[model samples]
Target: MTSTLDDALKRLEMAVGLLEASVSRRLEAENRRGDLETELQLMQDDRARLAVELDSALTRLHRFEAATDDVSRRVRQAIGAVQSVLVQAGQLEPEEG
Candidate 1:
């Protein structure tokens, strides 16, 4: 939907084309005709899979960081509250003569 996506698609297409050409040229040396279409399809599938995995990983990382920050904040607040209570209770306790 965005220009960035369009750019990425273009780059991927170019890379696929380059890969197909390279494989074909290399196979020609061995008297073999490689299936460029199949290779391209495989590459595309791999790219898609990696993209999905990356997105999932990034989402999880963000959630983990947010949860960590939330817990840290709560812990700091709890510690301060406990410290205050301890100080008050210490003052209230009668001292030995």
Candidate 2:
């Protein structure tokens, strides 16, 4: 009878130990899940901010392109005028093409 009781006690202790270990693992998993959720939120916020920045940069790029086109047109006109003046003064020949 004593041997049976000892065996039962040992089994009970082992079961309790296993239960504790399982609980610990579950808690750890929950903590990790919380951390992951926080990280995901941060990533989402960063993505939103980056998207806004990208849009602003694109808008600035378009504006710069328009300004560049305007400057290019003005430069071409000035070059043509200079060429005409040179041709009329007989300092340069008119282009054939």
Model 1, position 7: C-alpha lDDT score: 97
- lDDT string for model 1 (3-63, tens) is 9999999999999999999999887865533466668889999999999999999999999
Model 2 per-residue lDDT at 42: 100
Q: How many steric clashes between backbone atoms does each model show?
A: 0, 0
Location of the lowest summed lDDT over 10 successive residues in candidate 2: 88-97
Model 2 global lDDT (CA atoms, 0 to 1): 1.00
Residues 1-97, candidate 2: write the lDDT tens digits: 9999999999999999999999999999999999999999999999999999999999999999999999999999999999999999999999999
Residue pairs in candidate 1 whose N, alpha carbon or C atoms collide under 3 angstroms:
none
Query: Can you give the TM-score per candidate against the true fold?
Result: 0.57, 0.86
Report lDDT (Cα) of residue 76, candidate 2: 100
Tell how far residue 40 is off in model 1, in angstroms. Answer: 2.0
